[model samples]
Target: MAFYTDTIDFTARPAFSNAIRGFFTRIIAAQNRSIDVERMQDLSDAELAQMGLTRDGIVRHVYRDIYYV
Candidate 1:
């Protein structure tokens, strides 16, 4: 007579977990950039000028990494 046993994958799902973590990381980063843009918008023209930034350039400045503008 012969017998067989079933096997299970008890290892951690690093790939799936990493994907989820990456998704949340991107979301948090985007939110932080939005907050930065808002804070920059609240600054005076002179203050923005001191940082070499313009009111119309806030979004571009915050999203420079993702956008080419």
Candidate 2:
């Protein structure tokens, strides 16, 4: 008679899942920023000034947290 046993490890699963989730989160954030930039561009200079933002600074403003520029 003989007995055999095996074990499977799933330690990597959570790390992989987190990576995928982070990737999609960033994608969605980027899309939302793009929409914000477009909407901001449609506003007149006076309207943008009221918001304390400039057309040239739109992308930088939207991505300020991610980019230093």
Candidate 3:
């Protein structure tokens, strides 16, 4: 008796979708971060001090939602 085996491969379809999704995700994340930074920067130094934030920490604070988990 003899047994036969076959292998299947997929290319392009999944990778293309993932690449597109990644591109869009990066764009959206950057947009969100930009908006956050702009709003924070618009604040007076006194206001930012009241909030206990600094210009240097803006990126980390903007993306804190992603990092805390």
After superposition, the stretches of candidate 3 with alpha carbons farther than 4 Å from their true spots are 1-11, 64-69
Off by over 4 Å in 1: 1-5, 9-12
Distance from true location, Cα of 45 in model 2, Å = 0.7
- What is the alpha-carbon RMSD of candidate 3 to the true structure? 4.5
Q: Taking the tens digit of each residue's C-alpha lDDT, what string does model 2 give over 1-69?
A: 998769878899999999999999999998999998999899999998998988898888888999997
What tens-digit string does per-residue lDDT give for candidate 3 at 4-38? 76965678789999999999999998897899889
Worst 10 residues of 2 by lDDT: 1-10
TM-score-based ranking: 2, 1, 3
Candidate 1 versus truth, CA RMSD in Å, comes to 2.9
Looking at model 3, residue 4 earns an lDDT score of: 75
1 or 2, greater by lDDT: 2
- Expressed as tens digits, the lDDT of each residue in 1-69 for candidate 1 is 998779767566888899999999999999999999999999999999998988999899889989998
lDDT of candidate 1 at residue 66, scale 0 to 100: 99
Screening candidate 2 with a backbone cut-off below 3 angstroms (N, C-alpha, C), the clashing residue pairs are none
Clashing pairs in 1: none
Worst 10 residues of 3 by lDDT: 60-69
Candidate 1, position 46, lDDT: 99
Give the whole-model CA lDDT for all candidates, comma-separated. 0.91, 0.92, 0.84
